[model samples]
Target chain A: MHNEKVDILLIEGNDYEAKLALHNLKKHNLTNNLLHLRDGEQAADYIFATGEYEGRDISNRPKVVLLDINLPKMNGMEILKKIKSDERTRTIPVVILTSSRENRDVAEGYALGANSYIVKPIEFGSFSETITSLGLYWAIMNQEAPYIPNNLWQSISEA
Target chain B: MKNILLMKFFSTAAVTPKRFHFSAQKSEFEISHIPFKDSGVSVVNSSGQLLVAKQEIDTIETKPVMRTLHNARKIAEDAIIKNCPDVICALDRKGRFLTINDACVLWGYSPEEIEGKFFTDFVVADDIEKTLKAACACISTGKRTSIDNRCAHKEGHSIPMLWSVSWSADDNLFYCSGRDASDIKSAEISLQESTQRYRSLFDYNPDAVYSLDLKGNFTSANAKVAELTGCPIDQILTMSFVPFVDPEYMSVAAESFRKAAAGEKISYDLVIIDISGNRRHLNISNMPMIVHGKFTGIYGVAKDISESEANKAELKKLNESLEMKIMERTSQLEQSIKEMEAFSYSVSHDLRAPLRIINGYTKLLSNEYEGKFDADGKEFMTAIIENTKYMSRLIDDLLNLSRLGREAINKTIVDMNLITQVVIHELKMEDNSIVADFKIQDLSPTVCDQRLIRQVWTNLISNAIKYSKKKGTPQIEIGSYEKGNQTVYYIKDNGAGFDMKFAAKLFGVFVRLHDRSEFDGTGVGLALVQRIISKHGGKVWANGKVDEGAVFYFSLPNS
Candidate 1:
């Protein structure tokens, strides 16, 4: 179960800025198995198997998780903390996409265990290119760590 | 004819009655005559009877010889009486008095008394012996002479007199005449006083006065002219007056001298260069003078006017510098006006573009997709539209405040109570939910711009309403009071107050004291209020306690 591979998990706000980014990822076929979670809490349940997270395997995780900071309910920073602190989900690849070009947000995103930080551009052409390159890098080229449960005894049997 | 001639001679001789003679041979031959007083001849016999006397024949009495003798005596007597001076006396061979005239008698003596007295008694004691010797010498040598001496008068007082002495040879007497000499003595005293007055005026005059000859040379000068030119009086005598003038003005000095020589009284302001080549201002007054109908040389007076000329030049320089400073200040004021106009255009054009986009899109979404979307989705779009509208109002107010700070304010006396009341009424009309309690104090008069102060009141009262919306009654009090030399105004609200820690940021643009959910405001209100107050040369600030109340205060200085 720890060796099983998963597809994409998308976390964003305002369908306008995030949908424009998703249109370009389809060119590289990185949009396959993509799921759009509207806020930080839905993204947390998809990764953590908590609250209404029934029939979800706690060990299987996606190859890439795209996050946006400006969101309703729990912000992306609190979700990043939950994902990095859990033993079984610590090895998932996470990328941040945000509308703000402020240096404060960039510094804060990387400090919270986000693997990559990308500023969403206003122009459709530039936004598409940034999203395509970032999606291809994390989904295909980068290697992810094996998920480990809280009890280490079950991890040796799965390997 | 010979007998008649002898007869004529005898008869003419007989007319002088003092002659008595018969022939040269015999006296007793019977010749007799009576003598007349005027005629000197007489003829008589031994008897005292008339014999060919001057009165015997008419023809003989008419003889010219007798007539000539009588005429000579009358002339001598008339001359003595007519031409005698005030003091005349006759002296004998021994210097004794022979006779005295009426003039001599009036000299404190009687004619009979002075005739028998000696002439030396009337002479002064100091010169009596000398006068006697001079008189005796003149009489013996047959020469006439004169002398000046004091003579004694009959009243015992002496008078200065001049005596002229001459001797009569036949009578062996000396004649003397004396004239008074007192007029010459008084004329000598007047000459000395004029000399003293001239010397006093020469030493005391302020100008350097001097007299020059026909050639422009110094004849005499006072001490100041020598001191001013740094030359001694002896040196000035040898040096010509031309060398003391500046070299460039030498011809000017010569022309002045030429005019003076032509009998013209002329004056000129001349720059005189001394031995050290330092220029001085000299006012020279030159005049040609004549003494006793003879043309004398020019007289000159020179005065220093250097300080007055320097003061005039300094005043002119100060006036020029003052004009330059006024021109510089006017240009700086014009430049600030241009910059303010540009800032207003940027606020209206550049800033409004983005806000219009945010507002227009949100409105389009609500109108077109309101029925299809859930309730939460519709509410989110409405909030965005309201926030953008608030931002546009904030921009308009801020630009107006910035313009007030840049432009010059026209300060005039205004009543604070009336201005504050108008502002409070206007704010209440805009939002009826805000209940206002105006406890306005009788504010004193102040010198300030009325328009800028009105902006101050509008901003402060509106902020009180925006923050106090949560209060049940929404109580607000606006009032003013006098403190020392300033009039302080306050708008107090019982609303959601801010933390004291962030009170420093209350007057900054976009510095919100309350969250957007708790109170709805752009946060630019207090900033605009502060700027408008500052333009009128006043100050603004706020004080508060969290959740209790807030008070905004501003002050104007006593003008």
Candidate 2:
């Protein structure tokens, strides 16, 4: 299941929020190659091919990573910092999708190289609309960066 | 001329007389014979005492002529001794008065009555020894000696006398003269009393009174100077003022002293260390001591002000510490505000998530399983969704209210008429069923935070519409008028007015006057309106009656 081409990675800690996001993405037909991680730690492991995903191909990165700010382990901000700092996955667009509309979190998310910061609304219609637009935009409309091999990246950095 | 002719005839005739007799009544002369030279003639009185023997007589009647010349000389001498103003007296060797002149009346004594009395009897008891000593010295040295003593008067008062006595060895008597010295004595006494008064004034003064010589050495100092310098008066006088002055204020002290010595009165403040090493702040005044039209020294009066100086320093320190404490408290308040904002943000996010999920699933349940649900179940589901939305609005209003506290007001001149019109237009658009006729008048422009003031108008206008919409023809009037330094705006409505008693509770958070079933409200609108107006330094109040009408008024300062 982990070997497949992951188009979108949803890293949400809450079960209900994750289910709702998945449902909305499925309704929009953007869940075909989507992978949902329950916590920041699992998402980090999958993204960097560490821990349980050590043997996995690190070159096969997701197109977009949807991050929630509040998480159980290795919270969303820490995960965002790790992903943006690593050369292997820095190019992947990390969109912050959280329930918090706090200015501090929004500013920090963008400062840490998040592609987009969106607040999840409470109403069903508005929430459904936001998740659907977010999924369609990141998965279908947004252009993904071209993948470069590790040797090429190393050479480029040295040069 | 007749006597000269007679004298020439007698000389030529060689006439002499051993005894002469002349009677003015008889006009005859009898002369007795005596030895006589051919070229000289002698005239004698009837007692045969020779009156003149060197000159030739003109006739044997020369006795009367001789007696007349002697009487004239004796009269002049007696006049002089009788009229002398001083007590000119002759005293015997035993200090007895042999004779005294009429000037003895100055001592209340007659010359005849005091003739035989001892001179010492008239001397004051206190001066007797001095008078005796002076007389003895005069007798021994035969020199004139002067003494000042009091003579006892017959009236019992002592008369101050200045006596000059001389011993005459030929008569073995003391010739003494005494003058009245009352005036001199009174002058000396007054001078002594004035000096005493000045000395007391100097010593008893509270301030340190001292005099410094031209070289800045202490010449004289009062007792207070001893106390202030923590040194004895004698020691202070032995030292100059330079050693007692604090080094920091030595130059100032020197300058003031120099100016004073130059005859300029100078006053200055300086610090001094006393003998005990205690620092004393002093305000000193220095003036030139002009004695007998000459600048003699510097007179100084110093007042200790150490206590007041210390208090001033303490007050300055307290002011600095108070300012520091205020800054500390202000930062603490800012920190708490930041923390509260964080908490509100967390509440906004965390509290709404479950509600969102509940509402989302409920809507999905209603839409997907519409056939299985009965009418009541559907209504219950609808209520859940409605209540969730209401709770969400309540949370949003609460956040907005809390956020108002920390929001920095950006103020500008806002037109009240325009904001009211916009709010009215927006309210009409939101609910077209609001057929309440609006009577908006020309409003004065005021300085306020534009965004917050707009929110105020929105809340007030919507409240008016909501409360008055049930009337047949709801009449709403909005107008503003100038009140003192403020522009007061009012919104009146014909609606379900609350009791006037609960008017004070209207702006309280979550304090609803009407039941929820009658008027649908979360009870936070008026509170938000109040908060916004208050933050702008404005006031919000309402006047209402039961079922008649309610009018809300707000005043903004016209700056």
Candidate 3:
């Protein structure tokens, strides 16, 4: 059903890290319906279809949001808070894909309703391997949240 | 003196020559007969040693003997009363004096004056009862009795005197004789006073005072000793000090006792288990007790030192804990340093990622423009490759320096000579252009972190080889010796030696003295060597002159 709808939302602040993630996800064919955002602020807007995305569809929430902790404007932890606290967006599982492996960050990320915590390492092929498996899981294996069709998404946005 | 009077009376009754003998001295004496109607009596010396010398028997003259007896009144009056040295007096039954002698004057009285007064007037009031008893005995038993009493002297002081008296039944009077005794009485009083003073000092002293016999059995102990030993005074005195001493210190206790018994003043510290079985430390001083110039016993004074000893031990414990806390804080600081170094190293190591990206994209550009670039562009490509490789080497060196800081020091005994040989062997395997003649001396063993020390040796030796390689036969000497309580290992090289002025900068990271074209190096070798050696509580220094030689010395403190 997601062939016509967005399936995964990739949020990354670092340009290079974003390039690597997007490149690897495309290799698994999971990038076809994916939307890439640079910061937590845009990721949250795209998810809830508010602010700059005022007329955007909200019902077609991505099955998962690939997140980064270090952001330019709004940080990942704060974005995770907005998504999980709202009834309409709370079920969209968020996967943190930051380079930081600090225990405090991992613990705080999960406690704020993040679905999974993954530390991003820059060691050669490790980054590619991590994002590929993550893309395969969320796009192909993981079931979407109630499968809201395009028309339903438009209605939810209009309301 | 009285016996001589008796002999005189007898000789007179015998109607012979009428001679008399007196024994006051070892000589003869005679008292000429001038008979009074009152008869004489016998006499006594204060020492009682006098005896009548001879008795001349004139038994054939019975009439003369009877006549002598009839004149016994004369014998009593003249012999005992008149000649006695003591205060002699005759008192009637009413206690009135009838006759007084010359000694009465010594009591500030005369015979005529005291004869009519009461005998009690001459006796001290404190001794009146005793003096009267002596007077009454003469009347009741008709026998002589003496009592020591003080007679009141006219000057208001009392003279202690001994009086001998008897009753004359026919005359109804008591005849008394007194001798002075003030000297002996005063002496006895002084003795009593001194004994009380000494006793008070023994009983009232605050510190424990104990007396023991020559056999070490407790003779007596004061209240303070009883309190110190946690026993009653009476009970403690009944026991020897041996039971109170801890068994471990028994030998020392015995030695102290021996020295004290030997008449030497000795003192020592011992643990005493008091009555409650609590161990107490006591400082005891002992000396021999002497009586009549003979060593009779031992006396000791002791004080409880348990509290002071405990305080000293507590101070020592506090000092140890203080040292341990300082050590803990120092190690915590060291841990932070290691963590900070690891952070920097990890960041540098991560730089390899973007470096990989740069390398990949550059290759991508080069492939996209294959054969499309001019010679100048090709030269630029080569320069990029050269710079990247140089950066890679620099990053590797940076990581190594930081790794030395992060690694835990795993110390093991290392043979420096063997380690040097192995490092040189490795250098040959890595770069055969490092052709060198090596001179290695026997090196002492050192306890060090083996892997880190291997890195130290590798860096120092390779620098020595790399620098001196221009020599036809490159010379490098590796040796270790002791200096200033540290093991100093040095590497000497016959190569491009910098001036002594530049020696200070030799170990700075990325500081190279020579031109890069002359010798290819990362300029981090000496800096890494210095870092590793310093982590092992050592320091590195170099001494060199232009073109002569260079010697790098590093010293490790013996742990």
Candidate achieving the largest lDDT: 2
Interface RMSD, all candidates in order, equals 10.0, 1.1, 5.4
Q: B309-346, model 1: which lDDT tens digit per residue? A: 78878988988998898788778877876777665656
The best-first sequence of candidates by DockQ reads 2, 3, 1
Native interface contact recovery, all models = 0.00, 0.71, 0.06
**Native contact fraction (fnat) of model 1:** 0.00
Arranged by TM-score with the best first, the candidates are: 2, 3, 1
> Worst lDDT window (10 residues) for model 1 chain B?
B23-32
The digit string of per-residue lDDT tens for model 1 on A81-155 reads 888877678778788776444455678777878888875543334455677777777777878677667788456
Docking class of 3: incorrect
Q: Is the docking of candidate 2 incorrect, acceptable, medium or high quality?
A: acceptable
Q: DockQ score of candidate 3? A: 0.05
Per-residue lDDT of candidate 3, residues A1-159 (tens digit)? 122477888887767767767767877888889888887777777787777777776776787888877776898899999988776787888998765554567899999999999866443355567778898888889887775555766798899
Tell how far residue B267 is off in model 3, in angstroms. 20
Candidates sorted on lDDT, descending: 2, 3, 1
Each prediction's DockQ? 0.02, 0.49, 0.05
